[model samples]
Target: FFGDYPREMREMLSSNLPKFTSEEKRLLQNKADFIGVNHYTAIYAKDCISSPCDIKTYEGNAMVQAVGERDGVAIGRPTAFHGYYDVPEGMELIVRYVNQRYKNTPVYITENG
Candidate 1:
């Protein structure tokens, strides 16, 4: 399972403790019959260059603990693909990258529209 980017890090400790990810790759090496990857949407992470957030700064959404607001709308620099927005080449690149890294691993991508 590729839990690469946890939407919000405020789970238990850090604000975006993106768990699993490469961790599972090591932990479940031969433990499971089928290796699964659940990737639907990608996200951009914005680490605080400062400290813990105050009450007003966090607002009511615990998910977005200390993000910024522009024109009264909360936003972050999404971890989206560099070119997927305009072309499908991004998908090809991802496949090529994955192949180069995991040369012999059986692969499956369980995604939906």
Candidate 2:
């Protein structure tokens, strides 16, 4: 993994994000042997920063809304957990994203349901 925060995160959070010193960067760089992902389900993310939305707990403070449906159609089959959908493709997408983002670092599905 990179030593510092991602460029997109830094841009979004701006001064809200803490800076890392050269020593911290050196210590953090490529320190992880692998990435562990606990994937439960995939939900559509709607940007609330640019548009108005009814903020919910699932959305946290990221200003992004977690939506399970679009155009009156569900993203996937619903699970027992509210707002969670069983979307198999999400696993593939997440794994691919993590692999590419982390420079092809080894990844393990630590938890899934």
Candidate 3:
């Protein structure tokens, strides 16, 4: 649950979090009946807020540095595309997360192999 601020998010991105206007917040409430999730693979997450990361990326906004491997072991089966892995379990986890976060909203797997 989120209030004016999310505890976990605020712990990493304090002032970086955007302030939403009342109109925007109102518009966002129950805006979608279904949620579409585009999942590729799972990875190891590092707290870039506490440590250093080489490349700044979209995930960096959440202060998470994602890597495909840990301790020389890959997170999942490597795919032909770089950074994309074949991790079927990730799909289940992501969908479950969406269901919980979106109050069991109908979910569509928008993108997958």
Candidate 4:
């Protein structure tokens, strides 16, 4: 639910993933005719202490962001909020990643934001 935030907060959130920003730049090298922007809530990420980082990461409820309940309940995948984040910024990263990893192509994020 990253709907409301001040400019300062927005700036701060945007800074969390520096690697994604860089990758976006690399993608612009070839460029495209049309540009599309999709928006959504940003996700929170964390490192797994005991298990491998990959295992700790889930695509359902847990998703890419590391979220935990305030009461210490371990939240796993399949929860309602798993992929429900309002992180539209992730679209930016997706476009950027695609541009950097593959040939530059016009991009449009079609799924829900």
What local distance difference test score does each model get? 0.43, 0.85, 0.79, 0.48
Give residue 11's error in model 1 in angstroms.
23
Candidate 1 at residue 73, lDDT?
45
Output the worst ten-in-a-row residue range by lDDT, candidate 4. Answer: 56-65
**How close is every model to the real structure, measured as TM-score?**
0.30, 0.84, 0.76, 0.31
Instruction: State in Å the error of residue 3, model 4.
Output: 41
Q: Against the true structure, whose lDDT is highest?
A: 2
Q: Where does candidate 4 stray beyond 4 Å?
A: 1-83
For candidate 4, the C-alpha RMSD (Å) to the true structure equals 12.8
**Cα RMSD (angstroms) for every candidate in the order listed:** 9.7, 2.5, 3.0, 12.8
lDDT of 3 by residue, 63-94 (tens): 67789998798989999999978888999998
After TM-score superposition, what is the CA distance of residue 62 in candidate 4 from its true location, in Å?
15
What residue pairs are clashing in model 4? 39-88, 40-86, 40-87, 40-88, 41-86, 41-87, 41-88, 42-87, 61-78, 61-82
Judged by lDDT relative to the true structure, which candidate is superior, 1 or 2?
2
- Model 2 earns a TM-score of 0.84
Clashing pairs in 2: none
lDDT of 1 by residue, 1-113 (tens): 23343334345345435345566757745444433343433332343334344444333434233334444543333335431222234345555666665566665655521
What is the Cα-based lDDT of residue 62 in candidate 3? 52
- The TM-score, computed over Cα atoms with residue i paired to residue i, of candidate 1 is 0.30
The true-versus-predicted C-alpha distance at residue 34 of model 1, in Å, is: 5.9
